[model samples]
Target chain A: MLNVKDVKKDFPVLKNRDVVYLDNAATTLTPDSVIQSLKNYYQNLGTSVHRGIYQLANETTEKYERARKKVADFVGSDSPREIVFTKNCTEGINIIAYSLHHWPEMEGKILVTEMDHHSNILPWRFMANGSEKFQLEYVDVTKEGRLDLEDYKSKLSPDTVAVGVPGISNVVGTVNPIKEMTDLAHERDALVVMDGAQWLPHRKFDISEYKVDFLTFSAHKMLGPTGLGVLYGKEDLLCRMPPPFGGGEMVLKVDRRKVKWNDPPQKFEPGTPPIAQIIAFGASVDYLNELGISEVNEHVDRLAQRAVNKLSEIPYVDIYGPKEGESRGGLVSFNVEGVHPHDLATALDSLDNIAIRAGLHCAQPLHEVMELNSSARASFYVYNAPEDVDRFIDAIKEAKKILGGADER
Target chain B: MKDKPEIYNQDVVHHYQNPHNKGKLSDPDFSVTEENPKCGDRVTLQIKLDGAEISEVKFHGHGCVLSIGAASILTQMIQGLNVREALELTFDDLVENMGNPAKMRKDCASLSLNALKKALSGW
Candidate 1:
């Protein structure tokens, strides 16, 4: 079992601030080790990566590539060459949406779930502009907030070319069975894209085991720094796709009329990347490896379950997604009867300095399907404790009183 | 740094509970609905114009204390003001009238003002 006290000490904000942060799904608090790695990179050596024959340049480049290998290993990828660094998960999705037209499979229907974040949906929406390239279809979400597998099957016709799915719903906390979903998509000869922004932080992923064509996740969502995202594609698929971005050092040879792009990973990552952020991400991977992902996953799930049970006792509150003791991720989404979620969030902040996410949580289509305008979400991570859940629940009850009673509506 | 309780004082609660001019005009000159897309709070303002003078105003929507209260306050303020004067109503004026809310919730205080401005944009 992970020690919450020891884990809390590693987070500087937790040590310094009088707050209970339950917004880990948006971004996790950075550990000191990760911060130290970033400081070490800038303090010791600040130089451009890649081939520069000088000693410092070569050293920095080695560390940069080493970070890539560490991330590749953490995600169970076969080779670091499959990983391409981008701005964030959104940019990674865009890179594939823009580049995958090079393949013959690009000209068909695109399937995406209603539970996916806007980051996964908008890029494909922008790409499939007029149905000339691909027409977009949505796999329905059941009333209980799980992905409708029957709907997914009906949509998985031979015309389906790409399927973008999330490993976990940010709003609903439903852990999608991507392996099963991917296998079904594969049977139809469609490429599967997994948005792992929520899953990568909480669970251990083996790319070879799941066999997704591509995966994207944000470093900031984990204990790592921002301005860096990982896009992992199969070696063969990445080489076949073109790079949507172009700049210095992306090409082996470029003249006025012709350009010979670099290999798979290099071809996708054009221009100067976030060198320090990626290096610090290696430290984050090391921190997680030491703690063990399964333990972290279990700890987070327990907190979510605890929160659900506590909130369910209140007659006025209604929760989304699975019930207590069911399979869900680290977040609990809910709404109070008379109090708006925004008001609840503000009241919680004022009462106990608690931080929780409110609003659409970037899954508006899911909200529409559920017939809700917005909802409040409380997410947990390694540093959070059971006391945090008690405070969160007590604060919500107090917030209801302060905002006005449940019968006000 | 704000006393959040002060933002939801008796006046705000009263207006939120018993909002004035919160209905649709059966035959209105111009009507506009504005939404805070981030939070899904909406405000719809209906107006019946008597030439350049504001004849009647009504609003209805679902919102929190700040939004619904501000909408009620705004409808009461613009009942007889000219089109130009109604268009010139600001969020600061709402904040001043509501005792004082957090500057962070200026969007909440301004949702109805945004609707009023959009309703009279042609004028």
Candidate 2:
């Protein structure tokens, strides 16, 4: 069993208030170790990497590159050179979409699922709309909010260039079988792009075993600092794709008439990176490693299992996600009989300081498929405990009374 | 009952629960639907006009308390007003009519007004 109380102490925000933050899908609370790492980076040796040869600059460069290696190790990638630093997961998706025009092998349809976040969908939508050759299609979601495998097969054809899928749906919390999906796409000679932003933090990720062509995740969602993202691509594919941006460090040599772009990872990173955040992210990887990803995954699953089971017992509560006994990532999106999701979130915030997400959750198409305008979502991370879910349920009952209850159905 | 937040006062709650003219007109001169894409709140406003004067106005849709209350309050405000007068009802007027709402929710409180404005333009 994971020690919840001991784990809570690492996060200063959890210690200071009565805040039961259940919005981990948006961002996780940074731990003290990660914060300390950031302060140490700025207070001791604050300098841009690859810019100087002074003693402090050398140390800074070493730490920054070490952070890259740490992130690469954390994700089971053989080489740090395959990892490209970005602003967030959204930018990572954009990088692939923008660079796709340069690859002639990817001449077919871009098959994405309806369950993908707007970050995953909009870039492809823009790419498809801008180009006459690229055709974009969606894999339908099942009634249970799982991706319809049959629909995915139907969309997969010889012309399919890439299949963009979420490791888990942020709204519905469906834990997709990404390895199987990746294998299926690979059989069709289509690349797979996994939006790991929502799913990576909750489980043990091994890209080596999963063999996904590209995986993108935000550092902020995984107890690391904000303004930092990781895009892991296969060495061969990355070498072929065009750099999304052009600037100083990204080029081997630049002249008025001719220029040569730098190597794979460096080519992708153009400007001064988020050095402090990247250094701090290395500490977060250490922190999570100490706790063990399997333990974190189990702890979160237990909370979600308890939350879903208990919330379902309430007559008025309608939980939207996988059925009980099915595997789901740790999150519960639901609606009470009459209270609006926003109003319910506010009501909970008023009483218990229980923060949650209440909106389209950037999966508008999935919400439309579910016929919900909006729904309240409670997501958990390693810091969250079962007690938080209990308070959430009680607060929801209180919300129903104040909002005049949902229709009796 | 717990004291409501300023954004969810008794007036807003009452209007949300018991919205005014909440069903669509059978046959109307103008109708339109406005949606807040971020929150997925939507309202379709139907108006039955009498030439330059407005004979009836009703709204039917689903949204948060702020939006539903705004729609309810808007129908009451524009029922007797002319088409030009209804169009003149600005976003600020709706905020003033109801208690001030949070900055993030301004669109929620103005959904019906936007629909009403669009409907009046078609008229």
TM-score of each: 0.97, 0.94
**In candidate 2, how many Å is residue B16 off?**
1.6
Over the true interface, candidate 2 deviates by an RMSD, in Å, of 3.9
Find the 10 residues in a row with the least total lDDT in model 1 chain A: A400-409
What fraction of the correct interface contacts does each predicted structure contain? 0.36, 0.48
Identify the runs in model 2 with alpha carbons over 4 angstroms from their true place. Answer: A406-409, B1-7, B26-29, B48-52, B82-92, B100-104, B119-123
In angstroms, give how far residue A53 of model 2 lies from its true place. 2.3
Output the lDDT of residue A203, model 2.
Answer: 88
- The true-structure Cα RMSD of candidate 1 reads 1.8
lDDT of 1 at A315: 91
TM-score (chain A) of candidate 1? 0.98
Candidate number achieving the greatest lDDT relative to the actual structure: 1
* Clashing residue pairs found in predicted model 2: A108-A159, A337-A406, A338-A406
**Residue ranges of candidate 1 with Cα displaced over 4 Å:** A102-105, B1-7
lDDT per residue for candidate 1 within A1-409, as digits (tens), equals 8999999999998888988999999998999999999999999979889968899988889999999999999889869999999999989999988887555657988999999999989988988886587889999998789999999999899989899999999999999999999999999999999999999998989997899999999998889998889999999989888888888778999889999989979998878789899899989999999999999999998999999999999999999999889988899999998888888887888888889998888888999999998899999999999999999998888888767754664
DockQ of each: 0.45, 0.45
